[model samples]
Target: MSEAATRRGTTSIAPPDLLASLDPLLREWLPRQRWFAGKGRPVTGFALISATELLEPPLASPGVIHLLVQAEQHHQPIHVAGTPGHSSAPHADDCYQLLIGVRKALPPHLAPALIGHVTHGPLAGQTVYEGLHDPGIAELLLERLRLPGRLGELRFGRDTRVDIPFGLVPRALGAEQSNTSLVYGDTFILKLFRRVVPGVNPDLELPRALARQGCGRVPAPVAWFESHQPGAAAEPLVLGVLQPYLKGSADGWELALRMLAEGADFSGEARALGRATAEVHLALSRALPTATLGHTQVEQIAKGMTERLEAAAQAVPALRPYAPGLRSAFDALAQLGAEGRIWTAQRVHGDLHLGQCLRAPSGDWSIIDFEGEPARPLGERRMPQPTVRDVAGMLRSFDYAARSHQPWAPEWADTCRAAYCRGYAEASGSDPRTEPVILRAYETDKAVYEVLYEARHRPDWLPVPLAAVRRLAAPDPARDPGSGR
Candidate 1:
């Protein structure tokens, strides 16, 4: 598999075993990997869309891959992968063979326009070309990238092109923000989720409920996939979500770090972000569904935290010092369970972090990615916790923003931390009294978990959470109330 040096119209010496070319084995292999989106998916079969083999010289050195494989998804070919496997496959040519899938044959009208793309160039001492050159094959290529029109047909409306169709054989846009994304023809994006939680994925459910509840800011759901005849596992897995891609938007973390690093005043930005985030919690409470965040749920979550913490301590010895303290905090919170006060439950962003939020255009803060922490098993993730747990998570994130922005400068870290808490309190009208016990408990729990988390994945950043654990054990100096309200 030598590197393709040029591009041009191509020829295949051996008629590809369309099945081998379909890459069924690769699809089978995909579901088993960590990076694959179809976690529990049962891949039935694959369809082949005549891949443009740019180079396959006899001495092409066995396994160096430069491929453009169009694989079938549900019997229709799609531009599935651009690069090879997460790691290179076992057999040189055989590994790439599984990357193939099917393509839908496009309608006759689109033929002429699609065929215009077939051209020639040098790639691996050979000529490579793709586009509608094989009008028959090209039509098959085009159909796999599109869907039927609004009703009976399958093409998206013509004007849907964002990046528009380029002559480039489309590539499967990989996973992002915990959801799978595929950019086809540069006109549409397909998002798929790996963990198929039984109930509705909150990403769609809450946003739809909030929009009906008049909550703005969520990208309105345009099209969704759910079985009309619901199956045992028919909780819509969010196969794809169609929304206008935010142009010129940096993820909230990137924006915050840039703002903080530049020493720019972020008072207004902090306020707006806090307001929107607070509003999200409030909205989750107000509209959408509510269940008791009661003792039953609390005890289960406590047991889980205990298990995870104990396991963390076992695996990462550095986390031992905080185990007793972490256990104490959990026990103290469990006291509420003994008293039967764990009753307030609302739908929450299971995992809320800076990376999950976006600073959209117009300076509005938009929170996306409802999928919980990836490492947690699905059953554990579905458990209900206090909505303030989410608040606690984000509050921790603001601290993260400052610390992450300038590791060397401790100056003004306190000021930035206070401004953020100030923003949250003012927007949500959060009272320290109603949830004081639980809020502190949750925040403490978050910091301890952060300590254990940083120890494993990022040893360098371990001290931040260690310091936070110390700060939480003592009163947060930044949290002193002016009016005691």
Candidate 2:
């Protein structure tokens, strides 16, 4: 039997014919989606992993189908030695979760969600669209969370200690990347992970661990959903996580930008945020295992930083000139490691930045999104690293915010960064500034990563990190207060 026929024989929920016909529409629609990561690449084909009919025709106004699809993209081959005769794979596949809605006549309000009109199949002549945009279908998904149960291989789970009320109106968050989020009546927010991976996502894992440790700095996970494939030997992939929504909270990035615009002092807020971050780190360290990097490990860490700097220079030509200066920073770290210096590593907010924080109306800072760099492998992200890495990321964010605002105020970022470090020292009893070499190296490494990131993703934002690169590469006595020049 053909691939389509084999998939059709496996599932009885969504019609085989309807499932088979969605490939063409998905190929076009998926690339246009902001959450789709495989942009700029050709979608060669799609394979149906599983399709469950969430709401069937006649039973529901608009039919809803929960689809797990593996999309294959054309892979460009690289020349390698002794591989001239080796057969090359044509494409690479990535799994994506899509909730598709089918209706005969799409409502005017839902015109934005329309994928296209199905041409020929069981769903032919039907208006197919993204289901999350349809209010009724969105509500249905929330209902699944409210009543925890199993539907085929998909499982819904909720925290028994918490009570989640029913009938809350759902609205999708507009400015989400890498995932889709739904806010229900300002009480709860459900984040659906877009790219499916066969492991417990850190976003869910870390928050749950922090909640168990009684850490109030992070929103507690109230419920979640996951799916297990029939033959996969790996862990079940986490589909989504539901947590309490902080009402009347402003994101740290927005707060910083607003403060910068108004010429307001953000030192106090930055200090408080730093304290909150320290508390989270302390809590995580108490809850999870931590490792201390000795000579070998520290050397390995320095080598990794150096490798990243080299790679970034190769990718972004602008970084090439600053490579020597940046390599010096890494070299300093290597020297310190060679001298047998040891550093502590622990579970941290791997991807920390101003945007990853929120200032609640109560003036408390809450951390979210523990998922590390999205581009890195999952195993690498899961590994514990020096807490200073996170500190460097946030410090860079302060610089980014200042640069992003017109008429940049370098003094403002400096003040905020210093105050933040002071607050962290007060809370953690160890100041990051005291360890200047490691801290500076981490900050330099982070800026190098950002240079490459901004170059690839947002060319307009490239200057934000490049400015840091210039400042970091060329040490000015005025900027480096800790340096006894």
Candidate 3:
């Protein structure tokens, strides 16, 4: 056992047993956390994969321990295959990185960070809490990345020729969903990926590739940390990424909401953002491999969309009424595919929405969060998809903002969506609007996804996507090439 592990008394008790004792606490705590993805489901158990003491006594006033734990949720398989009288696995699992702080007595200032007091363990009576809430621990984490080093199984390193300044006060960024981010002064922000999976996270992979391709629309990665578990077959799991922070930039989502509130036109801003999206897409196509989706592949894509719609309808009762209309969109896509319509597929921002964008003071848009959809598997997210998928997501986002702003501005959303597609056509030399069938299909799929997302995460926002479902499901006379309606 390493020195830090020994000090934490990992030698005294097996890791599984140690984590088992804390499972009750974690089960209660994990679901309450904003970053927890398994919300609305019960966390049945936890399997501790690795634990490293980032900071221990003597090195610091209080101690900090970093842990990678797999939380298993109770799940029932739809059907069991190849079994006469047996059920499949009852649990689905997701891995999470936890930074736990240990102290003999909780300071009043650290009260909010408290996870709970360790009832029985080597560190019994010690108050345990989230370490990221503590600025000292956050600063220490940045310092660890500042100098290339390995602590236990965790490796912290920077990109070649990258220099990170030390001793800057760290503050946590708020309103993040799937990750915890700490900003060091005004220089850099380190995003700690909460739900972790093995292999390269696209958040790091895409930014690095874009930087190499000389794409300035993304924040440049400075350093990153990953963990390699012993005997693990897969590649190292990315734990966090550090990138230069763009100061004074406003989130695109907030900007759109603001514009809607003031009745200000956003077509120009939307158009420029569309161009920026094209630039990034072009860079990604140059940096990575691209694929042409033939009839067979397009059929598969359409099938996937139908599957998703069925799943969403089952989950959200509001979608049931609109299922027939939605099916028409996917069916049209399949018919188009059957006609040998070929579409280009390449790596895209994946989950491009207003919130994933930022507008700088220079009026240029920069995209962030290349992790794709948080709900999908990493492999699926990494797959190349039609660029119109991204374009459709942005269009859906425009509708989302307009509807969310009250008094529902459908005209505003339509105007911005058209301007965005026009700008994209100008930059990429491919008109997304011209492919009305594909664009409509992608937009409907995105809206279906939003229905489930809002139903689960934000119930009040359910009407936003529900309304979209009705509109997209209905055939548009204006969309008919022969009809002027």
RMSD of every candidate to native, in Å, equals 11.8, 5.9, 5.0
lDDT of 3 by residue, 81-105 (tens): 2212222332369899999887887
**Tens digit per residue, CA lDDT, model 2, 1-485:** 12221122124445467666887888889989987867656788888777777666434558777888888887654222222321223235878999898899888999999899888877777888999987787778877776577776788889988987777889999998888999999999999988787786888888989998999999999999898778757578789999999999999999999999999999999899889989999999988899999888988888999998887776677778889988888888889889988888988888999999999988999999987877677778888889998899889888888888889888888898988898898899988888888888999998998886676668788888888888788854234522211
C-alpha lDDT of candidate 3 relative to the true structure = 0.82
- For candidate 2, the TM-score is 0.92
- Shift of residue 114 alpha carbon in model 3, Å: 0.3
Q: Scored by CA lDDT, what does every candidate get?
A: 0.50, 0.82, 0.82
Which residue pairs clash in candidate 3?
478-485
The true-versus-predicted C-alpha distance at residue 13 of model 3, in Å, is: 7.6
Q: 107-179, model 1: which lDDT tens digit per residue?
A: 4544432211112222222221222223333223333333323211112222233333334333344335344
Ten residues in sequence with the least summed lDDT for candidate 2: 1-10
Clashes of each: 32, 0, 1
Q: Name the TM-score of candidate 1.
A: 0.62
Alpha-carbon runs more than 4 Å astray in model 3: 1-14, 57-59, 76-91, 480-485
Q: For model 1, where is the 10-residue window of minimal lDDT? A: 87-96
What overall lDDT, based on C-alpha atoms, would model 1 receive against the true structure? 0.50
